[model samples]
Target: MMNNAKHYNLSLDKRLADELKSIGFIRAEQDLSMWCGKERSYFSSMRCRGYGLHIGSLTLMAARIADRMNTTADVRERARLRMALNIVNAVVQEKCRLREQELLTA
Candidate 1:
């Protein structure tokens, strides 16, 4: 049973690493877009399709990181859930204004 569960830890670590890399890429792209004085596409079809995905992945990464750092599974799980929620909250707060503006112009 212990060995069977070992994969979970490895899986989580892999996922966290991938998520962090993705977030870094997304942030860099966003920064470039901002520097060019243009709106970065928000989960657009033409390009930057992973913009929204980054937000979610970032949240998951936060949770997984917290879980890995925590001592107890219960505490880790709770922290992970809260971290995920906070990520979504942050993404919503960050994007709400742009979305509202788009809606207003439409």
Candidate 2:
């Protein structure tokens, strides 16, 4: 079960990274951390702990990304941003579901 959870998190991380790269928003860890309104070590700590970002952070990040997408003039970049937004939204939904399940079990 632990291994499965770790694998799932790693997979999710890869998907998020790939989507961000596609949208050219992941030039550096500092840039991503700044966009998420977090310290530079935040992501590194999350990665080391094998967990994803907090739901609220993800939500804010998605909103910011969507705002950029809305103002983007390049068609290709807009499409890429849209795809990244979808990925972020999906992750946020999944995290919410997991949190709900935890609450119910508690």
State each model's CA lDDT, in order. 0.41, 0.75
For 7-65, candidate 1 gives per-residue lDDT tens digits of 43333333433443454422444432332234554223213232233334434444554
Candidate 2 residue lDDT tens string, 44-89: 6888888777778888889998999999999998887788788889
Q: After superposition, how far is residue 59 of candidate 2 from its true place, in Å?
A: 0.5
Against the true structure, what is each candidate's TM-score?
0.32, 0.76
Clash totals in order: 0, 0
Candidate 2 collision pairs: none
RMSD of each: 17.5, 2.6
Against the correct fold, how does model 1 do in TM-score?
Answer: 0.32
Clash pairs detected, candidate 1: none
Write down the TM-score for model 2: 0.76
